[model samples]
Target chain A: MAKEKTSALHENKGVSQPKDTNTRAIKNIRTKRNTKLNTKALVASILKSDTVALSRAITLIESNHPSHIKQANAIIKACLPYANQSIRIGVTGVPGVGKSTFIEAFGKYLTSKGKRVAVLAIDPSSSLSKGSILGDKTRMEALVKDEHAFIRPSSSGDSLGGVARKTRESIILCEAAGFDVIIIETVGVGQSETTVHSMVDFFLLLKLAGAGDELQGIKRGIMEMADAVVINKADGDTLKHAQLAKVEFNKALQLYPIKASRWKPKVMLCSALQNEGIDSVWKLISDYIAITSKNHYFEKKRQEQNKFWLIQTIETQLKSHFFNRPDIKKELEQQLELIKANETTPFAAADYLLNL
Target chain B: MAKEKTSALHENKGVSQPKDTNTRAIKNIRTKRNTKLNTKALVASILKSDTVALSRAITLIESNHPSHIKQANAIIKACLPYANQSIRIGVTGVPGVGKSTFIEAFGKYLTSKGKRVAVLAIDPSSSLSKGSILGDKTRMEALVKDEHAFIRPSSSGDSLGGVARKTRESIILCEAAGFDVIIIETVGVGQSETTVHSMVDFFLLLKLAGAGDELQGIKRGIMEMADAVVINKADGDTLKHAQLAKVEFNKALQLYPIKASRWKPKVMLCSALQNEGIDSVWKLISDYIAITSKNHYFEKKRQEQNKFWLIQTIETQLKSHFFNRPDIKKELEQQLELIKANETTPFAAADYLLNL
Candidate 1:
C-alpha cells in the first residue's frame, strides 16, 4: 500500500496531446547546433544546395532567441542575392479542400520535370492547431520522400505578423538552396491571405463546388486577390457543379477592376486525386509569368512587394511596442470604460494614453 | 510693368488660383472666435441647439494649431455625453455619380418630415481638390436654406487619418446640436470609403446604370461595406436601363455574405433630380434600423466602433511619431535602398530602425 505507483503523467511518460512541456530538449538542441555556426559558412552551404544546412538556417530564423536572430539576419542578407531567381507561388484554400493532395500532385509534376520544389506554410493558427499545416508526414508522403522536394511546417508565433515575417524570410533561404519553385501555402482566412498575396509572385485559390451558393465560406476580397481559382474535385459527380461554379466565379471576377499586373484571373477545373488538370494549372502560371515579364510587370511587382514589406514591418513594430507596455495595457481598459460611458472621446482617450 | 509698377501677381492682387497666401484673414477669424471660448460654455450652447456654436467647434477641430487642438479636445470630450443618439448614414459614389444632388434631395426629404438633418463630408483629398465636397454653397440651394438642415464641408488635412479624426469629432458636436439624421458623404475612393464606413451606422452606395459593366467603378471592398446600392438618375432614357441595372446589382450584392447587422443589402432605383424613390431609400434605412435594433447589432456595432477607433487612434499616433522623426526618416530611405538591393530582410531592417 505504501509503495503505490507514481503517476506516469507527472514523469512525462503519458503521451496524450503532448506539447509545451518538452521545449527544454528542443531549446538545448537549438543552442548546441547554433552556438558555433557562423553566418558565412551557412550561406556558403545553402548556396551549394545543402539541404541540411538550409533546414538549420530556417531553424535559426524561426528561433526567438537573440543570438539565433542575429545569425539568421546575417545569413539572410548574404543569401538575398541568390534568392531572386526562383518562382515563389502561394496556394490557399479551406481546411477540407484537399490542399495536401493537390500540393503533392503539383510538386510531383514539377519534380518530374527536373525541377526542385520547396513547400512552406504560413498558418497563423498553427500553434493552436498543433502545427497542422504540413504537420502530418503521411499527408504528402510522396512529396516528402521525393529527393527533389523540401517541406516545412509553419513557424509558430504569437502574432500573424511575426509568423508571416518568418515565412517570408524562409522563402529566401529555400530559393538560395536552389529550389526552382517555392510554394507558400496559407489557409483562406483574411489577414493571412493578404499577407501571402503581398509576398508571392502568383496566388492560386482552390475551391470545392458547392451544391449551390458557390460563394459560401469564401472570405471577402479573396476572390479578387486570386490570380487563378481552381475548382478541385472536378472529376466525379461534382464535375457539372464545378463547371457551374466556373461560370459563377468568372462573373464575380469580372466585377473587379483588372489588376495592375494586366493579367485577367482565370477559373479552372482540377482533379487532384485523379492527377488531372495539374499540367494545365502549371501552364496557366507559366503563361502568366511570360506575359507579365514581357510587359515588365513581374519585376515591377516584386520591387513593389519589397517596399510594401519594409513599410509594413516598421508600422507593426511601432504599434507592438506601444501596446505591450505594462502601464498602457493597464490604462487602456480604463479608457475603454470612459469611452463607453460617453465621458471621453476616442481621440482624447488616445491622447491620454500617448502622454502616459 | 510699362509704368514700372508692381505686378498684380507679386502684389497678391491677381484673380488666379490664389492659395497659401491669404490665410491671415481666416486665421484671425479663427483665433478671435475660439481664443476666449471654454469647453463648458461651448457644450452648453451646443446642447441648446446653437448651430453657430456647433460650426465653431468643428472649425476648432479642423485647425492644426496646438492651442486649437487642446481646445478642440476639451470641447469634444464635453460633447460626448450628448452624442451616440443620432443615426449616421454614409453616402459614397464616384465623382460623376451625382452625390451632391442625391444628398440634397435626401436632406430636403428628411427636413420635410420634421427631422433635423446634418450633412458632413470626409474627403481626404479635399486639400488637393480644393474642398469640392459640399464646397459649392449653391449645390444644395433648397437644403442649404432649410431651417432644420446643417451642411458642412469636409475638414482638410495633409493625411487621411487627420481628416478622418476631425470629421469624427465633428459628428459628436453635430449630434449634440440636436441633429437626428447625420449624413456623411465620401467619394468612393478606397481608404476614405473604409474610414467613412467605420464611423457611420449605414453605408449607401450610389451607382450609375453602366452601359454594360455595372460594377465598373466600384472599389474592391466598397460593395461589401454597402448597406444599400442605389442606381441614381433612373429617369428618362435610363429608366429601362436602371431596371436591368437593378437586377445586375442585386446579383452582385447577393454574392456577399450577410453583414454582421444581419441586413441584406438592397438595390433600388432613384432619380435624385426628379425627387423620385427618395422616400423608399428612407424607408429602407428605417427597416434596416428596426431589424438591427431588434437583433441588438445596432448597439453592438457602435460599441465595437468606439473600441476600434480608440485603438486605431493610438496606432496611428504611434506610427506617425516613429515615421516623423528626422533620424528615422533619413534612415528609412537608406533602408529602402538596402531592401531593394536585397542586402537585408525587412524584419531585420525594422529592428535596426526600432533600436535606433
Candidate 2:
C-alpha cells in the first residue's frame, strides 16, 4: 500500500487523528520564540519559491502535533507579508463531473500563459476515500511535470473547518512561493463548495451536459454562487446538450440579482478530455478579474473574506471546545431526548448544557 | 405612537434595547426554582386558551430583565407538553408584496374553518422601524378581532438570533393556548427569511407579479429556501401578470432538486385584497402536510429543528460572548488592520485575539 493509505479508511478511513486537536493546535502556539526561528527559515525558503519548503510549512499547518501547529502559525505569519499576489479560484463539481481533468487542462493553459499555477484540494471526503487528491495529482500527469505548475493533495480530516483552514493557509504559502494562480479544488459533498467559495476570488462550477445534471446542478443554491459555470465534456455527441445547458444556465443566472461585484456570471463550454475550450475558461476568469478590479469589488471582497475567516476561526474553535468535552457529549444526548419528548425547549436545553 | 414605540429606534426606529442582554438573559435563569410558581400560573391560563396569558408569557420571554427571563424559561418548560400541536408556516417577501394582507386573509380564512390561529412576526427591522409589526397588526384588524385568532407583534432586537429565539419561544406559548396553526411573518432583510425558514415546517415566499420582483425575489438564495411561492396581487390589472408569474415560478421551482422531504414545491396565484384563491393556498399547505406527514418527514423535520435550535442557541451565544467583549472589539479592529496590511493571516489573528 502507498504511504497515503494512512488517511484512507482502514475500516472505512475518515476517522483521522484528533478527538480535540483544532483548538489545541492554536493554544500550543502562544507567542513561542522557538517557533518564530524555525518559521523564519521556512519563510525564507518559501519566499525563494521553493515548493519543498512550502509543502513542509503546510504539513506543519496540517499536523495534529501541538508543536508543529505552533510553528505552522508562525510560518503563516512570516509568509503573510509576501502573500496576496495570486488569483485564487475554487473549482467544484459532483463526483464524475470531471473536475480533476477540467482543472488539469485549465492549469496547463494558465501555465502556458506564463502563469505559475498551484493546485490545492479541500476534499473532506478524501480522508475516507483513499487519498483522493493524491490520486488526482497523479491523474494530472502532464501538468504535474510542468515547472510552473505545482499540485498538492488535500489534507485528510473529518472536520470541514479544519480542512478548509488548512487549505486557506496553504494558499498564502503558495503565493509567497511565487505561484501566480492558486486553484482550490473540492468535491461536491456537504458544505465544502461554500467553504471554498468564501476563500476564492472566482468560483467556477464544472457541469456535465446531461445525466441528471439539471436535477442536481441547482442543489443547495450552488448555481447562485457560480461566477461561471463551464459545461465540461462538450465534445462529440454531448456537444449539443452542452449548448442547451449553457442557454438554460444563462437564463437561470439572470434571475438572480446583480452580484455585489456588479459583474455578470457567464456560462461556457469545455471538453477537458479533448482539451478544448480550456482557453475560454481562462479568458472568462481574466475578464472577471479585470472588471472586479476596475470596480474595486475585488479588493473589498478579499478584505471582507479576511474578517469572515477571523470570526469563522474563533467560532470553529468555540464549537470544538464545547463539543469535544466528554461530559457535554453525554449531556447533549440527554438534552436532545428531552427536546424530542417536548419536555424542554432547545433554548432551555442549551442553557442547561452550556452551564453544566 | 403605540406603547411599541419603545422598541423602535429613536434615531430612526429599529435599535431596540440590549447593549448586552442575550447571554445575560440565559445566565440569569440558572437553576432558579422560585420562577416555577409564576410560570405554573401562566401555563395554566395558556392551556385554558387565554390569549392575554399567552401574550404575557411571550413578553416575559422577550424581556431583557433577568428575573423575567428566568420566569420565561419556566413558563416555556411548562408549556412544552402542549406545544408541537401546531403547524408552523413562515411567510416572507420584500416589503410591499402585501404580506400583511395576505396573512390577514389567510389567517381569517383559517379561523373561518374553525381553526384557531396565532400570527407572529419576526421582523428584525422592527428595531429600526416605528413599530412595523404593530402597524401590521392594524392592517390585520379583522383577523385580530377574530376570537379564533391571536396576533403578537415581533419582539424588537437588532440580533436576529435574539428576535428569532423570542419568536420560537412564543410559538410554545401560542401552542399551549390551543392555537392549531402558527404563522411566522418576516420582512426580507439580511437573513431574517433564512432564520424564519429554519424554524418553520413550510417556508413560503410571497412574490409580486412584476416590477423587478424576479430580480430581487431570488436574491440571497431565498427562492431555494421556499417550499412554495405565492404570486400576490393577482386581481384586476395585475391578474394577467400574476398568471404569467405563476408559470415562470412553476418553471423555476421545478429546476430545484427535490426537497429532502421529497416534496415538490408548488407555485400559486393569490389576490389577498380580493380574497381570491385564498382557499387554494390552504389546500396547498394541506397537501404538503399530508405528503410530508405520510413520509414521516413532518415529525422528523420538527425533531431536527429541535436539535438545530439547541445548537443554534449555543453558537449564537458563543459569538455574542466573543464579539461583545470590549477588549475583543478593540483587538479585532487592530487584527483586521493587520490582516489587510498582510502582516498576519486571519487564522493567526484569530488565535491571538481569542487568547487575549
Candidate 3:
C-alpha cells in the first residue's frame, strides 16, 4: 500500500507541474485584464450616472489608489462643465432633529415639481464603520420610488471632513447626471456641519423646539452662516414650543451682523413627519436664490466657497504629509514623552519636532 | 550758518584722512557697545524677577531685532527648569462673564494661602490696537498689593494663538521667578480659549447665570475638555439661575465619554464679586490635579497636549509658508477672479494652485 501511494504522489507531482505554470499565467492575465476593464467601465458608467459605478469611482478616490485617482481626475475633468449647475443645499442639525425625515419630505416635494433631486447624506458615522446606513432612501420611501429622485448615503471610512470632500465631488457627478438640486445632509451638528456648510451654496440649519439651552450650545459662528433656520417637529404639542423657538432664533439672528447676501436669514417652522410646511421652506429657498442671484451675491458666495475648499484641501494634504513622515513621527513621540515627564516645554518640543 | 554747514559737509566728504574715519568708527563702536550692555542688563534684570526687566525681556522677544530672539531664547532656557512647577490655570468665558473680576478674586484667594500667583491675560482685541488693557492687576487691588503676586498683559500683534504661545513661554519665566500658580485669563470664548487651555494644567470655563443660549453655543467638545465649569455672578437674583445652570451642565457633561484624566468634571457656582465660592473652585482644581497625578493621568494629558501643539505649530508654519509664497499668492488671486467669474471650480482651482 505504501509503494502504491508513493507512485501515485510522484505521478500527481509530475502532472501538476505544467498545469500549475499554465494556471499561474492565466490568473495574472485575468487580473490585469479585469483591472483595465473595471477602470474603463467605471469611467463610462459614472458618466452615465449609474449609482453603483459612481460609488466605485468615489471608492477609488477615497482609497488613495494611484490608478483610480488618475481615472477619477479624468472623469471629473470630463464632468466639470456639467457640474456647478445645480443648487447645492447643506442641511444639518443636532442628533434626533429628524434630519432624515426632513430630507425625505423635501426631496419628495422637489421631485413632484418635476425637478430631479439628489440627496447625498454625508454621514460622520461613516468614519467608524466602513459601512454607511444610507438609510435616507429607506426612510424616504415616497422619494425613493420617484425615478427623478436619487438618494446616496455617505461612503464610510474617512474623516468627517474627508467624507464631505468625497460627497462634494459626488455632488459634481450628480449634477452631471442632470440633477437640478443637490441636498447634502450631515448626521449631526458640529465640525462636520461647518464642513458641509463651507461646501454648499445654501445652508439650512434644522433645530428642534427646545428650551433656549440648546440654542446656547449652538456656535454663533455657525448660526451666522445659515441661510435659513427651520424649527422641525413643529406639530401637536411641539407647535407652541416651536413657535417660541422660532421667535428666539429670530432674536439671536438679529445679534449677528447682516450677511452679505442682504437677505435676513428667515426662521420658519416645519413638521417633517406630517409633511407640513415643506413647500414653504422650498419657496423660501427659491426666493433667497432669486434675490441673491439678482444682486450677484450668489455668484460671489460660490466663488468664496470655492476658494475655501481650495485652501482647505491643500492644508489637509500638507498636514497629512507632515504627520506621515517616519522620522518626524518617532521624534514627535519621544518629545511627547519628555513633555509628559515635564522635562521639556510644549513650545520647545514643537520647535524641536518641526525642525526635525 | 548755512555756509558753515555746507563747508563742514564739504570737509567731511573731502577728508579721506584716517582721523575722520577713526572718529566715525569710534562713534559706531560706542553705540554698539551701549546697545549690547543695555540688552544684557535688561535680560539680567528680567531674570531677577523685576517686572520692568520682564517687560523688557518680552519686548526683546516681540521685536524684530536679530539679537533680541537669541537673548529671549537664552532667558527662556534659563527659566525652563523652574517652569511647569506652577499649577497653570486658564480662565475663559464670554465677554461680561466677569473674567477679570473672577481672576481678581481667584488671585486674591491664592495669595491668601501664601501662594505666589501670576496672572497673564490674553486679549484678542489687542492684536488690532497694539495695546492690551492688562487690567487684571488693577482690578485685583488687594492681590496687586501682595508682593507675591504678578500680572502680565498680552502683547499686541499676530494671531490670538501666537499671542498665546508667547504668553505660555512667558509663564515659564514667571514661574522661574517663584510664582506658584499662573492664571491665564481670556476674554470671550473662542479659539483663544482653546489655545490657553492647551497650555494650562487646569481649564476653568466661566459662565453667566441664565445664559442658556450662550451655554448652548458652546460646543460640547470644548465643554468636555474643561476641568471645571464655574457659573459666575451666582449672587442676588442670579443665584437660583446659577444653581440651575450647574445642574444642567452636570447633565450635559454626562454625554461626553470619560476624559483622559478619568476625573468627573465638576460644575460649581461662584460669585466673583463677593469672593464667595472662589476657594471651592481652586479646591476642585487642586483635587483634580491630585487625583489625576496619583493615577498617572496628569502626565499622559500633558503628553497629549504637547503632541497637539507640535502638530498645530507645524500646520501654522506650513500655512504661513504656503500663503507667503509669491507664486502661490499670484495664482490664488487669479483663481479668485476666475472663480468669481464662474470660469472654474474651486476644487480644480485648488488643485492647480497646489500643483503649481
Candidate 4:
C-alpha cells in the first residue's frame, strides 16, 4: 500500500511509472525505527508528562505501517488509565479572525495560572498547502515560548477522517501526559468544525466584530454547535462594534432551540492583541464546567462523544476499505456517471458497486 | 434474512423457539411470486400512470426478500428513462401543525390544475404506530378521493436510513409514473427532514400561527433547509398572528447567507381550511422551477442528490453489516462500557473491534 501511494506520488510529477527504490528505502528505515521504540518506556514517560514521549506516541498513532499498529494500540491502552482527566475545548474561526492570537492569549493565561495546556489542530486542508495556522511560530510566539504549553499543528497528508482519528487519539495521549487543558483548533471553513465539536467538551466559535461575513459563518452550521461565540479584536476602535455585535449575537442565538445541555451559550468580546477580556472567557468556561458538572451533563457529554467517535471511526474505516477495493474503484466512476445522467438510479448503482 | 426476521417476529411472542412451518411457507410463496413479477409489464403500466403498479414496484424496493433484488433492480432500470421528469418537493412540520391538511390542500390544487401529483411520507416513527398522517382518510379526504393524486404512507419495518432509501427509490418510481409534481412529506423532527431536503428540488417548512415551538423547529436543523416557510392556519383571529409570523420568518431568513441556488427563500401565509393563498404557493413553485431550470440549477441539484444518496446508502449498509455480526455486537457492549469508564479511547476501542 505504501508502494502504491509512492507510485501515485511519482506519477503526479509526470513520471508514468513508479521507481520504488528511494521511496522503499526511506519507508523501510522509518518502519524499523518506529517498531524499535519501546512502548512501555514511552507510556512511562508520557505518564510523567514528558513532551518528547508524547510526540513519539502521537507519531506512532499517525503511522500507516502495519508494524506500528500493535505498538500504537499497546501505548494507548497503557495510557488510557490517566486519560479523560482534562477538559477538551474545540476552538474555531475563519481565516483573518485572529484565532491563533486568541489561542495564544488563552493558553498563556492558563499556563500562568499553573495549568498545562495542549493544543492540537485538525486541518485536512493543510495537506495541500503544507502550511497551518498554528504551525506558524510567528503567530503564536508567546504560547510557543511558554514551557507549560504544547502546541501541535495538524498532521498533514491524510484525509479528514484519518486526521480526525489521529487527533482524537492524540487527545488521549495529551490527557495522559497530565495536561489539565486540551484545546483542539480547527479552521472554521468546512466540516472540520462539526467533527471537532463532537470530540470536545465545549465548542467555542470566534467571530470578527462588524464583519459582513457574520451570517456566512453561521451558515456553515457552526453557530448552533457553539458553546460560546467570542468576537475577537475588540480593542481600540473595534470596542463599540464588538459590544453591538455581542448584543446582536445574543439576540440571534435566542432564535435557536434550547440545547439539550440546558446551558445558555454566551456571546463575549475579546481582544487577543490587548489581552483584554481573556479572564472573562476563562470564567465562562469555568462556570459552564461547574454548572454542567452539577447537572451531570459534563460526564454525560463525554460518554456520548466517546460512543460517537467509536461509531464514526468504524464507519469511516469501513467506507475507505470498500472504496479501496480495486474492482470497486475501477467501476465507481462509470456508475457515478450513469447515475448523473439518470440512466440508472443511485440505489441500483450502489447495489451494482456493492455486488461488484 | 427474511426468514430470520420472520422467526424473530414469532419469537417475540415468547414461543422460545422457531418452527419454520408457517413462516417458511408464507415466505416461500411470497418470494416465488414476487420473483416472477414481470418487470416489463410493471414498467409499461407505470409509464401509463398506473398507481397500482407503482405501489407494487415500491413494495419491491422495500422488500427484504433476497430473490426480489434482481427484480427490483430490473424495474428501476426499466423506469429510469421516465424518471426525473417531475418536480420533487419536500414538506415538513412538527406534529399538530396541520401538515396533512396543508399537503392535502396543496396536492388537490395541483391535481385540479390537471397535474398528476404523488404524495409520499418518510416517517420511520409511524412503523410502531401502524398509522400515519397520510394514511388518515379524514385528514386528506380531498386528495384521497382525487383521481389525479396518488397518496402512499411510509414503508414500515425499517430504520430511518432504510426508510430514506426506500422513499428515495419510491420517488423515482412515482416520477416515472407521470406524476408532474412529487411531494415528499416528513415529520419536522430529527434527521429525517435533512434526508428529505437532500433528495428534493424544493423544501417547504409548515408552521402554525401562534406556536411557541417555532424556534424548536429551527433547532432541529430544518429551518435552514427550507426553501419556503408557510405559516399555515392563517384565517380569522389567527390572521394577524400568521402575518406577524410571516414577517418574523422573513427577517430571520435574511440573516442567513444566500443559498447555493441563489434563489431567495420566501415566507407566505395560508389557510388550508379556507383554501386561500394556495394559488400563490403554486405560483411560487412554478416561478422557482422556471428560474432554476433556466440557470440549470434544477439539473445540477438532481445530479448532486444522486451522488449524495449513492454514497449515503453505501455507508449505511456498510455500518449495518459490520455491527450486525454477533461477535461484534457482543464485544460492542463490553467496549462501550469500557469507554464510558474511561478505560479505553474511542479510537483504540474501534481498532480493537475492527481487528476482531
Candidate 5:
C-alpha cells in the first residue's frame, strides 16, 4: 500500500541505509531548518499516503496568509488527480446523540475490516474550541491509537461556508492519502448539516428515542435530507423506545416522496456503546454505494454536487463583495430601516439599491 | 362597509345627478376620452373601496408595457399606507385536490359573514394558460357573481419570482380596497407553493387522500412550510379515507419539530363539494392568527419575510447581472467543463472568475 512506503520513508529519514534514500526523495531539511516547505515534495508524499504531509497541506489550505494561497492551490491541484476515489458519507445529529463514540466505534470497525477510514467534522460554533469538540484524543481513544484511522477536527473561527470549503478540500487530500472511506460529521443545530450534506454522497441522521422531545432541538427541513435515520444508544431501558422510534420514523418517511435518486431512506436502530449494529450500518452504506454506483447515480450526484458548489461559491463571493462595499453598506442600512417603517416595498428598495 | 361605496359609485355612474357630482370626482380621461383619468382621483377612489379602480390598478401593475411602470409604482405607493392590514393566507394543493371549489366555498362563507374576500393565485407554469387554470369563470360560477368576493387569476407570462412579486403587490391593493381577508392560491407542484408561503401570513396545504401516492409529483421540502394541511374532497366514500389521511398526517407532523411560530400545524378534513368542515378550516386559520398575533410572531414573521424578499431580490438581480455578462458566460461554460472533468476545484474556479 502507499501508506507503507510513506512509513518506510519516515523511518529511514536520517540514518539512511541506502544512498538513494536522500536522493530518491526531497530532504526533510526544510522542516528542520524553518525554511519554506517544498510544495512539490509535500504533494508527492501526500500522494504516497504520508499522513504528516497531508496534515501540513491541509493546514496550508486553511491558512489565511496570502502567500500560502498559491502553494495551497498548487498542492490541491496536484492531489486532484487522486481525489474523489473514496466514498464520502455525512453524519449529523444534535449534540448528545454520542456522535464521537459512534464515529469511534464505526471507525474502529472499518479499520478492523482493513478499510482506511478518515473522519472529519464541521462545527460552525467551535471557533472557541478551535476544532472538533469531540475530536479530543480521550473521546476517540481507540481510533486515535489505530494506524488505519485518521480523525481531524473542524476548522475553527471562520464562516460556516469557509469551514465547509476547507473540509471539502481536505477530503480531496485525505482521499489522495489513500483513505478508502471518508466520514463527515456535523452538528444538526444550524446550517452546517446542509453544507456537509451537499458535499457527501450519503447523509445519515442520528437520533435518540426521546419520542417527540428528540425532534425539538433539531432545525426544521433537515429530516428530509437524510438518506438514513439511525436511532442511537438503543440499549437497556431505551431499546423498546428505539424500536418504536424506528417504526414511527419509517412510517413518517413513507409520507415523503421518493427522491430523484430513487433511494428510499431507511431507519435503523443501533447501540454504539455496545458496538452492536455498527456492522449493519456499515453494510447499509456499502449496499447503498454499490446500488448507486451500479445505477450511475453516484457519479451523477458527484458531478451535480461539483456544479452546485461552483455556482454557490460564485454567489457567496458576489454577495460578499456587494455587501462589503462601503457605499452599499450605508445605503442598505437606510433601506432596511425604511422597509421596517413600511415606507417602501422591498421590491422598490431592491430596485433602488441595484440601480445605485 | 367600504364595499357599499364601491357598489354605489358604479351604480351612480352615467346618471344625470346633481351638478356637484362632476366636480366631486376626477373624470376617467385616460379612457381615450377628452378628459384625463386623474391619478389622484383613482387613488382616492381606490381608498374609498372602488373595486373598478382597484381592478384597473392591478391590471396596471400586471402590465409589461413600459408606459405602465410609472403608474403601477404610483398605485402601489398609494396603497402601501393602507396595506398590511389584512391577514394574507396562502392556499396550495395539487391538481384534483379541489382547490378552486374550496376557495369558492370559503370565499362565499367569508362574504356571507360580512367580510370582503379577495382570491389570487401564483402559477409559474401557467404562462401557457395565461392565468389560473382553476380561476376559469365557469369553474368559480358563484364567486364570479358574488358582489362581495373578488377572484383574480395569476399574473401570467413571467418567472415565478416575478409573478410572486406582482401578486404580493396585488395583496396590498386588495387590502387597501378594504378586502379584510386576502388569500393567495398556488399549485402544489414546482416552486409556486414556496413563493406563496413566503408572502402570506398563514400557509395552508391542501391534499387529497391518496393513501401514499398523493406525495408524488410534489417537490420535497414544501410540506414543512405549511401552517395547516387540509385533506380535501372528504365527502361520500372518500370521507373515511380523508379521515384516515388526517390522522396519518397528524402523526407524520409529530415527527417534525415544531415550527418557529411555536404553533402546531393541524390536519383537517374538508369536503369543498359538500361544504363540510369548511367552517372548521376557517376556525383553524382564525385561531392561528389569534395566537400568532397575540404572541407577536405574526408581525415578526412579516418583518422577516420582508427582509428576506429584499435580500433575495438583490441577490437574484445580482446573479442575473453576473451570469448575463457575455464575458462571464463564456468563462462560466469553460469553468463548468473543467469542474466536470475534476481538473479544478469550485473554489479555485470561482476565484478565477470573480477576479475576471
Candidate 6:
C-alpha cells in the first residue's frame, strides 16, 4: 500500500513536471519539516505560560498554509504531558439563551477564585464571515481584563463539528498553558451541541426561564446528554418561572435511564447577567467530578469517549475521501438521477458506484 | 478496476489449477448467472400473484449461497416499475405497544378492503437465530390464513441496519408480488426505528396510553419523524387514558416544524385486538397521500428519499470494504487501543491508519 501511494504520487508529479517544479517541491518539503520542529519548541515554551509563543503556535496550527497539520501534530506531542489536567466543560443552549453573556460572567467567577480559565467559542456561522461575536474582547470586558482568563473565538472554514475538532485540540494546548478550566461555548444549534458534548468532561445545557414552546422544541436526545442543566436569566420577574421550569425539566430527565456514572445530573437556576449562582454552578461540577472519580467512572467514561471519537473521525475522513474521488462523484450523481427516475434501485446504484 | 478484478480471478484460477477447483469455479459463475435470470422471471410471475414464485424469489435473494446479491438485484430491477405503488408504512413503539398483534390485525383490515397486504417484521435480535418468527404462523393465524395477506420475518445478520437493508429489498419484491400495502414492523429500540423510517413512505409511532412518562421516554426526534401517532390498546378500561394520550401527543407535535408534506400528522386511538379504528387509520393515510400529492410534495419527498438511500448505501458498502481489508485490520486495531488510552488524538490516528 505504501509503495502504491508513492507510485501514485510519482505519477502525479510526472504529469505536472515543468521548469523549477523539482526545486519547488524540495523547498516545500524542507520548510514543512522545519516548521514542525519550530512548532514543537514553541509549544514547550507555551506550557510555561509564554503568551506570545502560544499565540504564534495556535496561528500556525490554524493556518491552511502548507504543512499546518504536520506542525500542529508536533506541537500537540510536545504539549501532551502537561495537558489533561483541567476540567473540560461544554456549554450549549438554543439561540437567544444568552450563551455569550453567561460565559463572560462564569469566566469572571472562576478567575476570582484564583483559577486560570480558558474559553474556546465555536460559532458555526462564523466559518464564512470569520467574525465571531466573542472575538470582540470588549463584549466580555470583565473577564478579558482578568490576567487569569484567556478567550479565543472560533476560526473560519469547516463545519460546526470541524470547529469542535480544533477547539478540542486547543483545550489540550490551554491545559498545558496552566489553565485549570477549559470552557467550550458552542453555537446553540442542536447538532453542534452533540459534537460539543462528545469532547467534553461535563456538558451543561442552558435554557431561558419562561420559554414554554422553546423547551418543547429542543430535542430530548440533547437534554438526555446533558450533565447539568442551568436555567439562565433567572432574575427578578423571571424567578418564579425559572423555578417552575427547573421542576419540569427534572421530571423530564427522570424518564431517562440512569447514566453510567450513576450520578443524577443537577439542575440549577442562574442569572448570568447578575453573576448570581455562578459559584454554585462550579461547585456542582466539582461535586460531579468528585463523585465520578471516587467510583473510578471518570477515567472509564473519558476512555470510552476517546474510542467513540477515534471511530467517528475515521468514518468521517473515509466518507470525505470516497466522495472526493472525481469518478465516484460523477457516477454517484448520474446514478442518483437514475434512481429518482425509477430506472434503478438504490442497491444496484450503490453496487455500480462502489465498483466504479 | 473491472479489468483488475477479472485478472485477479484469472490469477486465482491459474494458481489453483486443480480439476475440482476449476469445476467449482465454473459452477459458481454459472449459478450466479442462472440465479439472476431466475429472479427476473420470478418477479414477473410474482406480479401475477403467483405466491410460490414470490416465496422462492425472496428465498433466493436472502440466501447466503454465493449467488444471492446478483439474483436480488435482478429481481429488484424487474420489480422496480411495480414497486413504489404501495404505501410503505413503518410502525414502531415500546414492547407493550403490541407491535406484532397490531400488525396482524392491521394486515387483516387491509386484506378485507381488497388490498393485498405484506407484513415484514424486522427483529434486530434475529442475528443469532438464522430463522424467522413467521415460521410460527400460528401467532398470526387470522392474517396468515387470509389469501390476500403475506407475512415474512427477519433474517440473521451481523448488523441490525444490514438486516434492514435486505428486508427493505424484500418489500420491493412483495410490492411486485401484487401487495398493495406493505407494513414494516420493527422493534421498539430507538436506533432501529430510524433505520426503518428511512426506507418507508410513512412512519407510524404506536404507544400504550397508560404509560406515565410517555412524552419523556420517546425522543422528540422520533415524534417529529412520525407521520401518525397511535395510542394503541384503546379498549375498555384504557379508552379514557388513550384519549388523553392522543391529546398530549397532538400538543407535542405542534412544537415541531411542519413536515415537508404540509399535511399535519394526526393522532388517533386504536385497539388492534378489538379491530377498532383500523379503518380510520387507513383513511388518515389516504388523506395524507391525497393532500401531499395534490401539492406535488409526494414526488419531491420520494426523490429526496431515493437520493438519501443511494448515498447511504454507498457509504455503508465503502466502510465495510475498507474495514474488511486484511492487511489494514491489525494496525487499525492497535491504533484503536492507543486512541482509547488517549495516547493520540482521534484525528491523528485516522490519518495514520488511512495513510498506512
Instruction: Report the TM-score of chain B alone for all candidates.
Output: 0.86, 0.84, 0.82, 0.84, 0.84, 0.85
User: Which structure is stronger by TM-score: 2 or 6?
Assistant: 6
Ranking by DockQ: 2, 4, 1, 5, 6, 3
TM-score, per-candidate, Cα-based = 0.80, 0.77, 0.73, 0.79, 0.77, 0.86
DockQ scores for all the models shown? 0.54, 0.55, 0.39, 0.54, 0.47, 0.42
TM, chain A, every candidate: 0.86, 0.84, 0.82, 0.85, 0.85, 0.86
Give the alpha carbon lDDT tens digit for every residue of B1-356 in model 5: 45554644365446676665454244443342321255577788889988888888888889888657677787788778888999899998877788889998999899889999998888887886645665466887898788888888887788888898889889988988989999898887677887888999999988899765554554567778889999988888888888887877887788777888999999998888898899999999999999999999999999999989999999999999998999999998999888777789988989989999
**Candidate 6 docking class:** acceptable
Cα lDDT tens digits for candidate 6, A1-356: 45544543364434655767589899978987777668767876887787677777777667766577768777876786677889989998877888888988889888888999988877876766846757666677887777888888777676765776777778778888999998988766547777888888899999897745435666657888999999998999988889899998888788778999998987899999998999999999999999999999888877777777767877888899889999988888898888877789877888888887
Best by lDDT: 1
Q: On residues B33-125, what C-alpha lDDT tens digit does candidate 3 reach at each position?
A: 876677667656755767767767777666656666666766676566666677888888877788878888888888889998888888887
DockQ for candidate 2, C-alpha atoms = 0.55
Off by over 4 Å in 3: A1-63, A92-105, A135-145, A205-260, A264-277, A341-343, B1-59, B91-113, B135-147, B189-191, B203-301, B340-344
**Superior candidate under lDDT, 2 versus 5:** 2
Docking class of 4: medium
Candidate 6 local lDDT, residue B208: 91
lDDT of 4 by residue, A1-356 (tens): 45443543364345477666699889988866765558878998999888999998898889998667678878888888888899999999888889888999999999999999999999967888857766676778878888898888888988888888889889989999999999999987668898899889999999898753355446446778999999999989888888888888898888777998899999999999899999999999999999899999999998888899899888878888999998888788899888877788887788788877
C-alpha positional error of residue B240 in candidate 3 after TM-score superposition, expressed in Å: 11
The lDDT values for all models are 0.88, 0.86, 0.78, 0.86, 0.85, 0.80
Estimate, for each residue in B1-356, the C-alpha lDDT of model 1 and write its tens digit.
36777666665456777676769989977776765556667788989988888888899899988888878887887788889899999999999899999999999999999999999998877778656677777898998888899999987655888888888899999998999999999987749999999999999999998687787657778899999999999999999889999998899988777788889999999999999999999999999999999999998988888888899999888888989999999999898888778887777778889999
After superposition, the stretches of candidate 1 with alpha carbons farther than 4 Å from their true spots are A1-34, A37-44, A95-98, A156-158, A206-219, A229-258, A264-296, B1-34, B37-45, B95-98, B207-217, B229-255, B263-295
Least well predicted 10-residue stretch by lDDT in candidate 4 chain B: B211-220
